[model samples]
Target: MSALAGVALEHPVMNAAGTCKSVEEVDSFARSAVAAIVVGSITRQPRTGNTGNVYWPGRVYSINALGLPNRGLAYYGEHLPGMVERAHEAGKPLIVSVAGFDVGEYQEIAEVVADAGVDLVELNLACPNVWDGGAQKRIACFDPGQTAAICTAVGDALLARAGGDQAGRVPYGVKISPFSDPAALAELAAVLAELAGRPGGPRFVTAVNTFPNALVVDADHRPVVDVELAGMSGPALKPVGLGQVRQLRRLLPDTVDIVGVGGVGEGRDVAEYLRAGAAAVQAATAFWNRGEDPSVFGSILASWIDAGGIDPVDSAIR
Candidate 1:
């Protein structure tokens, strides 16, 4: 068994946000051997998402500019209780992934989801496809101040709901951008480290959201994605994501958990993330491309860990 942020997980694998968009998809994951399921990132209102060839799959990696299309928060609020119950029955935690255009929106969504009795909430700060007022907005994770503000707001919101106590409070984490720049990464890590030092602050941080703004072209040399750029995932991202997890693991105190994401396709990939100091790992493209039951991958990972084929360092922060 593995544990994240004080919660025990039957395994260390879970689905990434946006991979499971519908209630049916969430149910499919619950029935699988995945240790947990993170629902698609939900916005304040429903979005139809960007138009034109939004997804392109290749041999090495895949490109997507989905623009966070999802049903609004109200839809999830009404449906999540049942999903949470089903996940509990399957011995898994149902983590709600939330996104917003601004700080208040993030806090509001966090408060609502926390009250819904979901096991965890992930604040999505690194969706590169997000467009506001017909323009691409800056990724939240790139701004350490804004990122910390949002985390503080969400944490305070959850704590307020618990009558200013930490017990029985809902835990929350942030989904960070893939930092290709070491300086930017250290700045963000500093912000997270400070939050981790506070009472009722973020309990965990998920590293390496899909690398943003990849340009893929057609045979005619024209851009393939309608947005001209999209987030890239799959094998190409493993090195960058793994590096980010290693960096964050070294920066944050052991009290904070790290969830590694990006480019994970097999048991060894999961083991690699664990060795990098991730308490758990998440993925989407591998499951999407294979078009098979997610449990198949989870079972492979479980067997690898059980047979002692791979050894993960103790999850405690070193």
Candidate 2:
């Protein structure tokens, strides 16, 4: 079995957060090949999300500016117990994506989800569409200091579970933006490295959210999607994602897992991330393009198996 952050996955293939938000989607994951079920990047209040055509999947890649649309943390926290049970019943873990607006929000989310018994928390530090009063905000992953503070706050919340200590704190992971500079990655890694072995520290790092500020136009010479620019993903992003994974695998402590995302549409893509040092991988564009069908995961897994399969990453050459 493949594992991430000490949680066993039926395999390394799972859906990216935005792709698995609804209750029906949760059920679909339980019936599919995904290693785990990830619920939100939910906020304190429900968000209507960006309107208009905020998404476009092309021949090689897809672009989206869907915003951080969700039913909010309360909805997620209220239903988390059932979700966790469903995932566990299916022999997988349930990881919630925490999209807090601030460090305090992260703590609040941790308290709620942790109390509800989620297996893992994914701290979303790099969503390009996070807006404040309709104005887009900066992504936190780019600021090392902010990243540390948020992580510490979440850790503190988890600490409450362990009686003022690190032990028993729920392990969390950071979903960060793709970096164009090695310096940026190294900076973030340094922060995460400090928390690598400590309880309540991040135990996994999701290599990318999406390449930000990417624009695509249709034949009319106009922006294809309603948004001026959006986060890009799909086959074209594999190189960037793989490079990030390779760099992260080198930068992070081996004990921390690396989840590779971007441009994964098939099993070969999944294998590519594994070869690039990702312990597991997430597929978003492919799943979306296939209409969010859970079977897409099964097909991806089957394709991976057909490609002669990969030996466990712990034994394979990376």
Candidate 3:
């Protein structure tokens, strides 16, 4: 078993936010072998998302510009309690993903979701496709100041709702942008380190939300997606994600859980992240390419571990 903060997970695998977006998907996760289920990114108001082609699957990678479509926090406020109860009955924890246009919006949405008994709240600060009032806003994870402000506000709100006891507060984490530059990653790590020093700050950091925007064109010389740039996922992102996990492991204290994400498709990939010092790992494209049954990958990991194919400190050598 792996534990993040005080919550124990049966396994270290779970679905990434936005991969499981519906009641049917939630029910499916409840019955699956994944350790937990993270609901789609939710906003204060419902969103219709972007138009035109939104997803493109490739041999090595996939690109998407889904634009954070969701049914709004009000809908979740009413339904998530029951969903949480059902997930608990299945012996799984239900995590909710919250996204907002600004810090206040993040806090508001997080406060509401916290009251619904969610086991964890993931603040999505690195969505690359969000457009506000017809203009693309800067991804929050790229801005250390903004990231710190949003995390502080949301953490304080959750703590207040928990009545001043840090233990009673629901653990939360940040989904940050991928950084290939060492200096930039160092800056971001400093921000997270500061948050970790806070009395009731984030307990975990989900490394590498998605790589920077990418563009794909078709034979007719037109963009495949309506948007000029989309987020990249799948096998192409594994190396980058692995590097981010390794950097975070070296920089952040062990108290802050690191969730390695991006491009993981098999048990070997999950083991790679674990060896990089991630407490857990998450995958979206793999689930989309492979299927909803998480055990397909979990079983492979189990078999590999039993065979001593993975060593926590040096998985490559093993």
Candidate 4:
């Protein structure tokens, strides 16, 4: 067992947001061995997501722009209460990933998730696939100022829903894109530290959204997917994810937990994340490669336990 953001988890492994988007997918996670149910990087409106050859998977790496396809708020909202109950019955907390077009939408969607009684919320600030005209939409985590604004808004909303005490309220975190530049990473961490000092601050940080704008081409010299570029994941991304987690662990106080993500394909990967000081870890490409089957988690988790994945100072399992 493990704990993330003060919520008890049966294990440290849970599916990443885009890995499971539908009510059925989320419910499958609830019934599976996963420690939590992560639903949506959902938007205020229904999204068909990016279509037409949007995904391509490689042996140890995959790249494609998914465009954050989701059923929108109304569909998930109506089904959320039931999803939460199912998760609770199975001894797991429901964590919703909120993605919005603007700061106000983040607050609004988060309020609905908190009201539905989710145990945790993660604001997705690093989606690199949403295209507007020819360029991608602004990624929230890149700018410290905007990141602070979004976090402040969402925090205030969640705190208010809890009647001003975060103790009984839904805790929150941010899923940030991977950083290749030390100075940039430090800048964001400083902003996050400042936020962490506040009452409505982040309870945890999920590191390393896929490396953005990666384009894969086949032997035929054509783009692997329909889009020119997409986020990259699989084994190639693990190192970057680990580096981000390690740095965040050192930079952020222990009061703010860290959840590691990237290129995690097996039990050893889980152990690696723990060694890097991740309270928990999430998976996407690994799960996708396993045919969206929950058993993949069981296998990977079994491997982790065999590898002595738990660490007193690093792993969240005490």
Q: How does model 1 score by TM-score?
A: 0.94
User: lDDT score of model 3?
Assistant: 0.84
User: Best candidate per TM-score, number?
Assistant: 4
Q: Between prediction 2 and prediction 3, which has the larger lDDT?
A: 2
Summed backbone clashes in each candidate are 0, 1, 0, 0
Mind giving the per-residue lDDT tens digits that candidate 2 earns over 197-269?
A: 6667788999789899898988888998787789998888889999999999999998889999998778788
Worst 10 residues of 2 by lDDT: 309-318
Q: In lDDT terms, which candidate is top?
A: 4
lDDT of 1 by residue, 223-313 (tens): 8888899999988999999999999999889988999988887778887899999999898887777764676656656655664533445
Root-mean-square deviation per candidate: 3.0, 2.5, 3.4, 2.6
lDDT of 3 by residue, 1-318 (tens): 677666888767788887776677788878876788889799999988888888877889988898999999888999899889888999989999899999999999999889999999999998989888989989998899999999999999999999999989998999988887899888988888888888778889898786768998889978888986999998899899999999998998777999999877777788788899888888888676665465555664565466454444544425
**Comparing 1 and 3 by lDDT, which wins?**
1
Alpha-carbon lDDT, every model: 0.85, 0.85, 0.84, 0.86
Order the candidate numbers by lDDT, best to worst: 4, 1, 2, 3
User: What value does the lDDT take at residue 219 in candidate 1?
Assistant: 94
Model 4 steric clash pairs: none
RMSD of 1: 3.0
Distance from true position, residue 213, model 4, in Å? 0.5
lDDT of 4 by residue, 198-250 (tens): 99999999998989999888899998788778899888899999999999999
lDDT (C-alpha) at residue 281 in model 4: 92
